[model samples]
Target: MIDETPVLDDHLHLDPDHHRGIDAVRDFARLGGTHLLVVNKPSWHLGVEAESGEDFREVFERTIDIVDEASSELEGRAWPVLGVHPGLVSRLVDDRDFAPEEARDLMQAGIDVAAEYVAAGEALALKSGRPHYEVDDAVWDASNAVMRRAFEHGADLECAVQLHAEASEDMTAVATWAEEAGMPAHKVVKHYASGRLEGPTPSVMCDKERLETAVERGELFLMETDYIDDPDRPGAVLGPKTVPRRVRWLLENGHDEAVRNAHVETPKRVYGIDTEATLDRTE
Candidate 1:
């Protein structure tokens, strides 16, 4: 029987402490059983100088530089889907605690500083909220610009975005906005608020109809639950092996092929190259 296991991973974070250099990434890639399309979103805190500033572009670039140096040493074994994840938008602007006018001025200044934040190579820090968080229009605009750059770069990369739905109405709006914002034919993963498939907290459960609609429109959608059961947080896991279980369920239910087509095939067509082969060029 052909191995039915998914050959690709849409998301993964390498251990920074261990993989301090390219040599480590090279070794990790050579032993790879699954092809990883890693999304890099870096951050620092407010009132704190990050050694680097607190934007995503800088962090992601730094991480990519490491990967590139390693790839040169080892050859291609991994690929990246670069973007400034939405979750950090608030944090990026929080330091300024900007007045509405100042916020507007900063946004008008061109999103390069925001891009610098990503290139700095810091991990995003998130705080738990009650139900949902409203994305400020300014931050959204800046993030979209960064995403556009990543899309246009057309390198050994794909676009990756994630969403969590807590309120039905809000989720509907999110779904609509996502559809409008060129969500079609991009790789996207969904994570529940509590981080599990079943029994998700109110903040995480999304309206199924809306989600299905997004998928039908050609947005690659995969459910990821590993973060739900994060060991760092006591009492996080509500289900056993939630990520694998959700993946298995989605596959058995026929969502896998549909997502694969959008995430993998369509990207190949757009970029005029097979990502797998490109990843094989990893050095």
Candidate 2:
């Protein structure tokens, strides 16, 4: 099984303080997972107020620390993806008493800091998009502004940008925006994507039915668990080892090509990192 194609989770969040981080990753490795793109959890979850951009540094560093921690003691590799979540705009305005414009400025500043990490090659991607839920016009515009900053940064770094926008709506314009920002549509990922609302390269969830649909459609799609890593909820979105387990399902059920494309080729195309090469050759 180790000689088989590497199983990569495109968006897996690990909150060590609350969710037994390394232990959870060990679960993934035990089940044949080889790589994880460890994403930054929202700041509020870490009890961060984030009054300024620098306040986000702690979360970004901790995200990097998670990758470093896993790499030190485990064979499975991981990369940090840092950015200010777009929901921060609504939080700043409603919960924190910040004006819409002020919230926009703050979130933009936060992305600037995350971009520095990407530029330094400490992180592989930036996570940004408007809130998944509905918002008023002012908040929506501000959130779009923040998302644009993320696309702009991703363009400059030539890295991926994982979006967390509304899943029910079409994202045609979103892909156009990525192209407009000079970032390829494939590099602008749709994180936690349903069968619908996907960009050119959809990072589909690790589910049997949805995956079958994605495969039948015959497009280059990636898979992820979207594991929230919350102790209380445990596997709210999906379990820690869902991707590898699903890959096994695909292989045992005669979907070998799907496994290769989703697990190996698609990621190589989007991020330019060869999972198989890294796991097999490089030290």
Candidate 3:
């Protein structure tokens, strides 16, 4: 049942402390997942205070190393999505005593670092977005500005950019920003999305109606559990196997093509991953 169709979990965190490295990657694989994109977990998930740009950089580097280790252990089944999360940027600026200008520079520096990895084929995509829709105007603007900088870098590298915005926020504006920054709408993914939103391909949670809508529209979107893999909050957002479980459900419901698109084709097109190569790897 787990091997009938290839599955890719587009967003998740894998850390030595929480997710326990290859053990967690094998957990996802055992559930039928063929590939995964490992995003850097926030400071809270790492049990540290990201009070400076250096602290955030450490987190990003650790995340890349974790993904590299997992991919090696899994034989290229795991990939890295690197970036400076907008929430971390806000904290660095607002809470860490760094001026907004300084924080923006640091955020750009982080994107540059991620771009270097992407250029080397070590990472798949770049991520940046507002923490929430309700941040004050100044913070909101700053967040968008930093994300826009990331977009510009992604554009230069021909890499995809994933947005971590609230599901309810209007994402058309973000898409417009990406376009203005020279990134195509298809290269911009709206993460943790729900409801009907126009603009950028959406990477949504596994809900029947949402999945149906995306399939019906022949939309280029992906599905994820956004699984945090935290020990304290077991399956905190969703379990490591959530995406594969959803794929099974979709397949049982006779949406085979949709399942393939969401779990295989979409991820390959958006992240530029070699799905066949990933699928060819043995556990």
What are the lDDT figures for the candidates, one per model?
Answer: 0.36, 0.85, 0.74
Model 1 residue 52 distance off true place after TM-score fit, in angstroms: 9.8
Which of 1 and 3 is ahead in lDDT?
Answer: 3
Clashing residue pairs for model 2: none
Q: Please identify which of the two predictions, 1 or 2, would achieve the higher lDDT against the true structure.
A: 2
Which one wins by TM-score: 1 or 3? 3
Highest-scoring model, TM-score: 2
lDDT of 3 at 167: 68
- Give candidate 3's TM-score: 0.88
* Candidate 2 residue runs with Cα over 4 Å from true position: 1-3, 196-198, 280-283
Q: Give the TM-scores of the predictions, in the order they appear.
A: 0.47, 0.95, 0.88
Task: Give the better candidate number (2 or 3) by lDDT.
Answer: 2
Q: What is candidate 1's CA lDDT for residue 133?
A: 63
lDDT of 1 by residue, 147-247 (tens): 33332321222323343224342233333343454443222233343222222111222234433554565432333222221234434422222323333
Q: Which candidate's lDDT is highest?
A: 2
lDDT of 2 at 115: 94
